[model samples]
Target: RESNNAMQMVEGLGEDDDLLRVAQELPEPSDLLESDDDAPIIRLINAVLTSAVKENASDIHIEPYENRLVIRFRVDGVLKEVLQSRRAVAPLVVSRIKVMSKLDIAEKRLPQDGRISLRVAGRAVDVRVSTMPSGHGERVVLRLLDKHAGRLDLSHLGMDARTQATMDALIHKPHGIILVTGPTGSGKTTTLYAALERINDNTRNIMTVEDPIEYYIDGIGQSQVNTKVEMTFARGLRAILRQDPDVVMVGEIRDLETAEIAVQASLTGHLVLSTLHTNTAVGAVTRLRDMGVEPFLLSSSLIGVLAQRLVRLLDPATKEAYRASDYECSVLGVDPADPPTLYRVPDGLSAGEGYRGRTGIYELVPIDDSIRTMIHDGAGEHELERYARTLSPSIRDDGLRKVLAGDTTLEEVLRVTRGD
Candidate 1:
């Protein structure tokens, strides 16, 4: 079956002879700069894109090495090699992608970022294209943003009843900052979008300043940062505040200026939503403090912080029930004598291999009066974390809960929450 799938992918990209023949038949220099609707390269690229969307891939990688050109797809947060073609065809494929994204195909020396908005299988997809120079050739990556996937509600975000209730209350709060902290590709943007969707009633003026708007939703004013034109997160956020926005979503708080602006915005009256690159919920406070935000300001403006990670779910058809070891039971906070029935991704399966799609494991920390007091007093991360444990489960604990409930494997949870 795997070989058949590979053959299909190869056929989709066409054989090397077909690629070479089409490359030579191209219309000199000018046609190469334009997207030819009937071109073989166009069909090959489209086929790859269509397959990616159909397979629910998050990113498409076109990498060229000394021996061959490789195409990979990141599905369920794992990259898999899907196809390989002739090394000589690397330039043609890279140039075609650059042309399609409207980037300077001739400028192969520097990095470039662009976007492609297209429909595949009747579903709208927004592809963020990035190209970088390599020894063999230019390497390109396409980040796929499925509009349907972006519409996930909070209830469908793998949050338990209590966590969902906490999230609902936090997002509905009139004023204060609620942060979704996670590393890149950890579904931070999706969570923020879900919160915005929940509160978007057309009565409130919702506004956002994103590095690049990933998904489009009606009734919300979305602005993209244009650094070339002096528009950055801080600058765009400043402009958003003046627009009479009831709620503001900053894609990320990267600098002290942006963090201060977000804090001030929340203090002034608008509810603020943003993300931070942190390993845990408590670490977000320390990160902001390190960014020069006053502890008091952070305590006052912060309402909640949700730390999340994506873990691949087990394939129910293939998963087998097993017994948990003593250490596993201890980690899950269960007594060894009453170890729960656990499930794994089959016995012979190798590590880093996925069983099915991915789901979120989250730590939702709602800052209460006591926690607020702790933060206002400049409490350390260890202290804050110790307090947070009393209110909600840590990210790893949440993952373990999913493990106990048979949602995912213990290994999958530990894989994502290794830092914790």
Candidate 2:
């Protein structure tokens, strides 16, 4: 009887019209006890959160269409579409989230943003929500920020020992700029956070200027970039410099002004750390120079560059594992006949696992005299790549060495690096 009534109520409502009204007037659970569809939509949202946490997902995206809602989760830097809900149910689900976030229900054409917190298994989790207009309907993205996940160690980041040591040395410098270069989702932020953690001291002042301020750190000051109101990286850096900070972290070096400011800060007795969207570490210098910063300024201000890429890790529990391909072996000049494995599995040898967790493959180059001279002379990416190759092993070699050493799986390395 209750199920019949709720279905009748839904039928009485017009399609996609006055959704808020119907949502506001939803019958109590007791009044519609038998209607599963009439059950509070909050329960379904909570279920999604629970499942996402269980899968260790970092983000959730909900895309609504004329007939359905597609839900995706970003886990370990990979986006996977997991579920879909009927169009009749999507609005209720979206409305519940909007209500929880205290957003305007009637506003569908414009973007809306909000956040919510929840406790699961005695751990507090922060979920950042963003909704934007789409052709069929609104698309929603939620970034799950788990504070309890804690920080990661440098060694665990898949960087070779030599590169790790180089980074360690760079961070210990009293003053200079250390720029991490990579495409987005290359774990640059995590690497910077680890470096910051290493230098964090009670007596020192470490500040950061980020767009959305992804994660929170103890004993460090982080500022969000608000371009709408004029709190950009350049302005933020100016203010941060006036505060007598020992170390400064800029989220990105986008414009020439911000790059100039960061370089200037590094030249003037401040240890600056920031990221650039370049393919390689050496490319960072060239890109900065192209951004109107003089070569001399770069040669003087820049101290080190760490370029990285993410590789996938194979599951140790699986019997059929992965092996480095001939192409990969060729890249590292490793002979398959004389296999000197670093990390391996007992069962061994299978095709890729579609995808796996990501590991960093780094090319860290310290700005020594030779490198400085090369940069001053307008060196290209090849120069940097050649120099980096000479100073350190290729990313493949380091990852294969780690695989042979049993630090990480061969499949995992190949997964991200797309090796053999």
Candidate 3:
């Protein structure tokens, strides 16, 4: 019913081209808040959200300054200014968002987090709303998760054939933990979901314990962590194990307790999936050991780790094929004498940004007996990484592969995997 109401509220609001015009038509700031009917403000907010969804934006930023209000949309992992409004109207806009997300409008001094489920033009969207106090005013960010983005599949996750096959085999195991490691906003959750989807079928029970369930899939049990009631990843994961789940997904392994529980679950005949906030696949093992998961238990339960990063794809229409320079070849580890022809974004497109979409470049390492021995012996990150390098490509290598394949540019690859 709320979704329907949200859909109805956005009805008749201008779309991409007319969103600014609709915002311009908003009533006076004071009048917007004082009016009994919130139709004007509602329409303006609805239009902004609708346009964002239509644009496939991952996040929406509503920032207020002393002189003006700036609304930006994060598209393909890059922020672009979408709309601007008068500074006087910022409060009304922020207040409306709070009301829709069911947050306290009066509580602007403290940061607040809320979720808003809406259906915009028949598209189901789950928005994670966060508000923070700023010098000028309250700033808002909305993470738009389009529930109808369709089925998650490994084949669609931009993994190479060998990596996808390895992932498929890892997730299909009857027991063991498959970890996807990456920094925040690097498509770790999406990759996990795709792995789950790949293995999801009748005759096996799949369950998840997430901080907040981002996407809902049929035939899978997903539980949200409610810290207000002391329900957390560890608690929820323990409960899930009691339910006789064949597969378990913990949103993240934040502490030793959750890591131990996940390790136990994986060892006790459950295929476990989870993520870690590490920059590389080998770093995940080190992070787990640092979190107090015994090296022996990690060795026995860990099956593989996939480290990934999002790199913007060059605009095919504007990209020109060119031979890589010797410096580029050296950076990419390609033989300098015979550099490969690579594609690059020319200066004429999208104001030289020259990127239209993003794809994940991944480093997948499947744990074998040798690597397991190293893990059991309390190997450090450097030692494990040195050995893991022989087993799989590094994240930068994968990014370089994508660059050579013309899926992305060297500059973009370097931009995302600079540290590696």
Candidate 4:
């Protein structure tokens, strides 16, 4: 079977050589620039960005080395190099981005940041640019924001049936704090946006405070944080509270002041949704407690916690795609009748047969009466994990079941869950 597959792939490649050549020949930004005239560099950068929008890339990375410039794009959650330029052209590319973003082009030793808006294919797109000094040279990262890719439904987030049910129950609560915890690029914003979408209605006033609002919803009031002007998360929350919102979404709880305000908002008449940096749902409680939040306040105001991660999916259509090793299967407690397989890709993807996008694997902890009592008694993160494990079936176990059932891919599960 493997030999036949390889022969077929070779034949297919032979038939598509022209298409492959065109794709390979797509010019890099540096290739379009002239040695003396700088206009080409600007045009080239715009062209690259235009291509990115056309290709639906979420982020672009420009890394400069001693002898070359490497350009990479993050689609879904995977970073893949798209172009390489000669050493002579690296400086021009970097300066082009800095100038477009309105950063200090002359300063290379320090970090700088700015944003720009460009219209590609008749659609407006926002790009957030940040540059930091690296060992080889300056590293620039551009986060692409497409307003059209609005909030998604909760059911579309790849949660298993049991986990989805638990999450739904928690979000239906009228007043409490729900924390979605995960590292960066783990779909924290997407998950919270799904929850907010569910609760938004004509009867309720929903307000959100984000550093720079990523997505806009029609009925919700969104505020952007401007730290340069002293409009921060804490201050924003205070202002949002005065507006008598029934539900609030804080982009992230980064400090004690914001955490305290979020808790207080929940204790009052509002339901608060926010994100935290933690590895698991249970860890969220411990993190809050460690951040100086009173246990009693947490026990009362906390509704639920969701911890998630992003992982690569196995391309189901790619015969030679990597599979979960036996060790990974064991860690996820895979059943013999139905083994885990890499099947589906992540969100916002379009490429490769086996995997084109990434999916989110989440563990949810809803604060039931018993769990609330545990929190009230100062039960640590371990206690919450233990209790979560004692439930009928675990999130990890159930997630593996979904992989085996072909609802999602094991590659995605392991990517986010780190099963082994």
Candidate 5:
């Protein structure tokens, strides 16, 4: 089964030979500057995107240095440089990308951001383009959004059985807030969105206010926030509440007004799902209080908080059981004589199958009576953490189990946990 999965990861590379050849072998776009036609440019764009998708890359980066141009891809949260070309041609290549994203090709001095859709391997792939001015030239980064990348199932999110059960109970509550807390790129959005998808049975009015809508879910009324026109998170959320949504997802609680509105909505029989930028589940409560949300109001409307990080799954084909070190056992709170860790080869057998995808390692805090009392009394983050630990497993504990089960490595878990 492991080998079969690895095979699927590299299965379609043969079909991308044409596109990769054009992208890798073609001379600098500057060399073809004499022609005004855009066919070659379009082909170049296709090649870059096709290679990126085939490699299961999350983002593609084109960087220009003093003497050369470097093409890199970010896979499994690490950036690896894959291609190199002449420095003179990098600017023209970036301009072609700007064209696709509908950004101003003529304005290279200023930073710009835009999005574009491309057909790769007969599928639509969304690319978010961000270009910035640099010392040598402009740098281009494209975030690839694949529609079929993963299924939005709550049970399949890689939580421990207990955490999954706790989540199932909280999300079904008719009111109160469920917040997923993590730093940027820690997979908070995926977890919250999965919860929304799970409860979205077309029996309730669902609505969301996102800065920019990332995923499209059927039967949910999604709105994008445009600050220029005064459609900010706080204002938009207030509007959403008026629309009679049974469930509401605010992309993020970015400010005081938004946090207040979401908490108030939760008190009024609306299930509010939102994300917060914090390191721990307990930290979310302090974060809200720091934004001036009253403790009583917050405690009354809070259901639970999920603190999560995305860790790469090991290639089962290459994973091997190993004795845990003293430090490892201490971190996981397990015996060293036991096979407490599953170590895998850094270079997996294949791209997609072995370490092809990621799963959530989480620490969840379900706000019970005791937790609510602590919140109302204005407890500190550490006190909340200490209290929550008795009810739910820490993120580190959940991650170590995956290590013991050959699902991931201890080092991968530590890396995503910020070395906790």
Candidate 6:
């Protein structure tokens, strides 16, 4: 919903031109996949694929109802219908996707999930395919996992110097659990991979267990979770520990058993990196406790928490500085004597040029002996947050720094941070 509002504020830039360029760069469909070349159906499918890639669309949707089939691209979190066609061609296009994904096209009554690798614009794209039964026909949704997102290291993830240094120290620790917390699509996976990359060593055995392995990094053994085969996160991590690994990356701690195993791994002299679905760093303490992880274990083996959110960066070409408002100053905890500076995109700029990609705003909470004692005593989330403020900077302060540096807008920071 937040991203939809952001995209609605401005329109896409060079949309038609992006599609045209991708179409020209494509080699024949026969070369890319085992499909009949020179067929109109193949041409339409190829055109859609290249166009979606050029726009950096995260997902492509083909929805069929009573009469027409609508094709929409989820660009920057919002769904925009690019092309609409008759229901006649919908089956052919969806079938082509299923073939590439190695899914059973004939069994459309039951929902199916599969993956396809497509080389578009000279880059390999891992597309996650899902098909479900609808009123009139089937709905095909393709989630594109572009490797471009995982290419970033910590230095390039839009974090401040102090926060980055704190993270570096936390990740390099030989033993302890460092968890990244945020909602879905908050770049938690990218941050986890980046932290691992910084401390990754050939001498140390580092392994990761992801739901569906998204990024491919050499020298790292990645296992995909297959519930069908009884290979869940808990089972996978238990197996990985027997191999004598120095570092373990559990994609996410979804359940109590997995969380308990991750904490146990940290206590047993391994650096475990993972993510939690929490809004703030302090909230993680309460969340884990609610998940049945004992408070004593959390305080002992926990290293630090880095809560982050990705906010769209302002276009440097059109960035404009403005004075911070009274409410903004209060929220940032800035002194009125020394007013804080803020930045944003000037009005009248196109959405394409309004903001470029995104940068991260983080709240770094490094646990100290005092904070640990508070946790051990079963402190509430509010108390932990107040105590943590003395040990680290608040997320609001980090957002203000970005606004002062013209990296993002005040509104955007508030949106991602939930105005806390």
Best by TM-score: 3
Ranked candidates (TM-score, high to low): 3, 5, 1, 6, 2, 4
lDDT per residue for candidate 4 within 92-170, as digits (tens), equals 7788777667788999999988877665555656778989999878889999887664437789787878778888887
Q: Which ten residues in a row have the lowest lDDT in candidate 2?
A: 1-10
Worst 10 residues of 6 by lDDT: 1-10
Q: Comparing candidate 2 with candidate 3, which one achieves the higher lDDT?
A: 3
lDDT of 5 by residue, 40-142 (tens): 5556656667777877888999999999988888887778777777787687788877766778988879999887755567665667789999999999999
Give each model's whole-structure lDDT. 0.86, 0.74, 0.88, 0.75, 0.81, 0.80
Question: Model 2: per-residue lDDT, tens digit, 58-131?
Answer: 89888888877788888877787777656566666676677666678889999998776666334456678898
Tens-digit lDDT track of model 3 for 18-71:
688888788877786677888877877888888888878899999999999999
Candidate 1 versus the native: TM-score? 0.90
- C-alpha lDDT of residue 23 in model 5: 60
Model 4: residue 151 alpha-carbon error in angstroms? 4.8
Off by over 4 Å in 3: 11-17, 30-34, 149-151, 350-353
**Cα lDDT over the full model 2:** 0.74
> How many collisions between residues are there in candidate 2?
15
Q: How do the predictions measure up, each by TM-score?
A: 0.90, 0.83, 0.95, 0.81, 0.91, 0.86
- In angstroms, how far off is 88's CA in candidate 2? 1.7
Candidate structures ordered by lDDT, highest first: 3, 1, 5, 6, 4, 2
RMSD of 5: 5.6
Q: Per-residue lDDT for 1-420 in model 1, tens only?
A: 212322233344522334234444545434554644535566567677777877789999999999888989998888888777767667887887776678998999999998876766567677799999999989999999987744468988898999999999998899999999988999999999999999999889999999889988888999999999999999999999999999999999999999999999999999999999999999999999999999999999999999999999888888889999999988788899988999977668764454788889999999999999999999889999999999998899899888989989888898899988
Give the per-residue Cα lDDT of candidate 2 at 110. Answer: 96
User: Once superposed on the true structure, which residue ranges of model 2 sit more than 4 Å away at CA?
Assistant: 1-39, 319-329, 339-356, 403-420
